[model samples]
Target: MASIEKHGPSWRVIWRYQGQKQRTTWATLDVAEEAKAIVEGYRGNRTAEQVYIDMGVLTPEVPVPTTPTYREWAEKWLGSKTRISPGSRARYKQQFRDHIFPTFGDTPIGDITTIAVGTWVNDLRAVMGSPKTVTRYYSAMFAPMKAAADQGIIPVNPCKATDFKRDQRADDDTGEHKAVYFTPHQFEQLRAAFPERWRVLLDTLVETGVRWGEVTALAKMHLVAPTKRTAARVRVWRAWKRGEGGQRYLGTTKGRAKRSLPIGRDLYDALAALVDGQPDDTLIFRRADGRELDYSDMYNDVWMPSLIAARRCATHPPAPRGEQLAGATGRCRDYGGTRDSGEPCGARVRPGTTRCPSHYGPARNAVSMCGCDGVLVIDQPASWHDLRHTCAAWLFSDPRMTPLMISRRLGHATLATTSDIYGDLMPDLEESAVDAIADARKSAQGTRGKGARRKR
Candidate 1:
């Protein structure tokens, strides 16, 4: 039997098992009654431990271990992640260092309450300056705690109760990171801006939509049927990625999928010419000295200059006071003249052209002939990866191309990935579907009318 007694404002349940007395306190009489029932239920065959279990005070069959500090568990958790890529491991370590350790590292894992986690999340958002960054830090913190909970070191993951919204800005129409692409004509203009030696590389990028790592890893042996004018294909087997400490290494392509993409006649011819006389395993693209292409050098020295020259005019006037006075001295002799505001023209000029695009009429191969230096500045800034975006855009322009086709071409692991990234660029699928249904119905009605007339 069990008994209930009132101690001031609170209620207490009392009971005895064997020879020892047992008791528990509750804030309300209703809870006291429930506790009394649980105490009485264990009277016949069950023990006191069973009664505690029934009262929701003890978990059955499992022993609670000493709780480790958050830092101890996090370190152990990170060390056990042996399968993640080196780059990913480095990023995770950095997150632990910069975000996780400072606040909760030394605290006992069991002491991390939900309220504390929620407060810490708010602090992280304030310090990190963006919802996206806060979310990443939160994930890093949550992972270790979750592992601890799973292993029975903690009762529950406090992070699970913390609320944080995923940053949706990337997917919003006005997102700062929205994908931008160039038209074929614009691509040609950009290609022409590069020196003749580098144009083939640009062609491969725009045509194949392979990642930069895959492009850099392309070898002569990867090209199959190199002499075929229209049906040549490039096999993507591996990719080059820079590991931690800036060491370059070869690895599986993203999603670990190997795929082949067909090359156009122009690209095939270009590749055939480039690979002529080279060893089968030699890289198709390299520096002038035949060393492996350094991505940083390529972007800074080659890509940026070409992009600037292709998109802008040299409106920048010569140095005002120094040797830049037109024909006054050495390197400044060819500086373009003054701007409309009488300021020295600061716009960059084409290599051989005397004036910036603003002053010059048009380059021989200029696409729009608008002679507007503002175009490049106003358009979405281009990055190396945007070449992939350009390829997707061109593929989407064709009404016959499907998302699955684009996904295969891009070597993506799933159709959903392709659709999620490039769904906006796809032709109006709903409209096309409705139109096809209407056309089918119309054809059926015409066939029935003809049948009725024949019957008549």
Candidate 2:
């Protein structure tokens, strides 16, 4: 037991060690409280002299073994990791530098408490929008502390003691987000909106559900033409990856497993046209200069523009009966009008008002002659990864495709991975699962009836 009390113009922490009472006096109450904490923690198995040394009450005959700082231990832990990919290693380093180091870099590894680690995680969850992203950073921080524990540097890993259950929000909560993907109709409109040159790339992505890196790394040899006994397929064996040093190269697939996905005749023809007369080693999808397409450039320059154009066409269709349909009363509002080019005046205006003189009316029926006319439009936002989810959604909607089949098609590491993501989306699968148990019970009852009749 330890207690802190006031002495003459100072504070004293009194405790017992090795059956003898010990006391340490400090100039301030804070210092006395800190000494009290040290005394309380120095329980069984710790050397008798450690308490005195930790409180700076006694000088040692030899140098005391000091615990490494969080940064020092983290560097050693990261260096010892050799099995991870260069890209993964780079990401881990980035997570440490950006998220963990600022708060705990100089803190002694042994001194970091579970409460401190838990507080850091909560702060990150507040600052970062996504819980999954926060979890990744948490894992990066947890690994080093776990290694420190294994190496006898600390008594326990503080991170392991944290209860993450409290941090999780319900699916419908404001901060929580689920997978975002385009519906089939929306995808069709989006695909139609893309330029002719890049349409096949989008087709391949939606059909096979391969990752962006995996699709970009595809070569002519990876595509296999249909035969008498085989279906047209694409072999996914490798992917384009960047290392910690920022060098790009072909690397193993994310799961380090090779999967061959059967493709439709339409997609096969599209892919074959790209690889026609090219060497087997030639990339199936690349820039005209024979360079791999960068994600940032493609997203900004192509995907976004195409997506916006498609949404616009969906919202605004061609004028009814060749006469521009205006508003609910079939007439333009005070601030709405057409320009000299016969296009609607798209100038910005004040909300809920026709005050701007730049146009005839503030509101009008959407009227645009675009390729996506009469096509279902998608207003929801999406990203490149959503293409993969789109494929999964499509597969789940089809009765012919089972969950296991969808998992393999998406190149998921396990069926559980696929189910964890798209399981709730598959109402048919859930119904079938219920029916299977019902059918099994009926079959068992019938079998028992037959046995009883035979015995009779």
Q: In terms of lDDT, which candidate is strongest?
A: 2
lDDT value, residue 366 of candidate 1: 39
Write model 1 residue lDDT over 1-456, tens digit each, in one string: 788999989988877665677777778999889878765543322345655676787788777335778888888998998666676677778898887888888998876777778888878756765666776788888988999878877656888865554443323433233666887777877887899889888889989999998998888899887452457899999988657676888888988879988887778778877879998988888766776788788888888778867766556422222221242321212464456567777665534555655555533223333556433432555777889998999888888888789899999999987866776775576578899999999989888856454544
Off by over 4 Å in 1: 1-70, 104-175, 226-230, 314-378, 433-456
Winner by TM-score: 2
lDDT of each: 0.74, 0.77
**lDDT (tens digit, per residue) of candidate 2 on 1-456:** 788888999988777655677777789999877877776654321343666678777899998668999999888888998777899889988998999999999998878887788789879978995777877888888999998888777766778877753225445233333557787777887788899999999999989999999999999999889999988999999998899899898888888767999999889999999989999988999988888989999998888777656655535544432222333232223344455567665554334433333443322333244545545454446777888888888888888988888888888889887866675677888888899999999989888856454544
Q: Which consecutive 10 residues in model 2 have the weakest lDDT in total?
A: 322-331
- The CA lDDT at 303 in model 1 is 84
